[model samples]
Target: MARIRLTLLVREDWRDRYPAVLERCRQAGLVIERELAAVGAIAGSIDEGQLLALEAIEGISAIEPERLNTGLE
Candidate 1:
């Protein structure tokens, strides 16, 4: 299975329920990278096949796959 990098947007003030969120992500087989707490986001990699499962996890607002972009403002 192809692994893709993804950024997961979560509910506001996500730390209050971080443990639940972490468990959910782990269950989705994601290799967690970093936590952006202030913005309620997480970075990680997971099999492409698991995309839908990840999205279905509670509290996830958006799933944005990594993309290529030149330095354009």
Candidate 2:
């Protein structure tokens, strides 16, 4: 059960690497939930341990927990 959801920010300068990043995520055991084109981000879930390895991937700007915003944060 891939219950952990995360959002990955793709660096604007590295948009071309999106495909590679997606593959890396899958290799890390993350089930890609969605891809936000306008924001250059990707959402997915994986085991907690697999996430740490993603930091080694170039072009990934940020990895954050996914949440719905109602403007109250």
TM-score of each: 0.83, 0.77
Q: Runs in model 2 with CA error above 4 Å?
A: 1-3, 68-73
- Among the numbered candidates, top lDDT falls to 1
Can you write out model 1's per-residue Cα lDDT over 1-73, one digit (the tens) per residue?
A: 8999989888775667866887799898989998876678889999999888898898888889999688896
Against the unseen true structure, what C-alpha lDDT does each candidate score? Answer: 0.86, 0.80
Clashing pairs in 1: none
Backbone clashes per model, in order?
A: 0, 0
Best model number under TM-score? 1
Residue-by-residue lDDT tens digits, candidate 2, 1-73:
3367888898898887788877877787778889876677888887877777777777789999878788995
Quote model 1's TM-score: 0.83
Would you give me the overall lDDT of model 1? Answer: 0.86
Deviation (Å) of 12 in candidate 2: 0.9
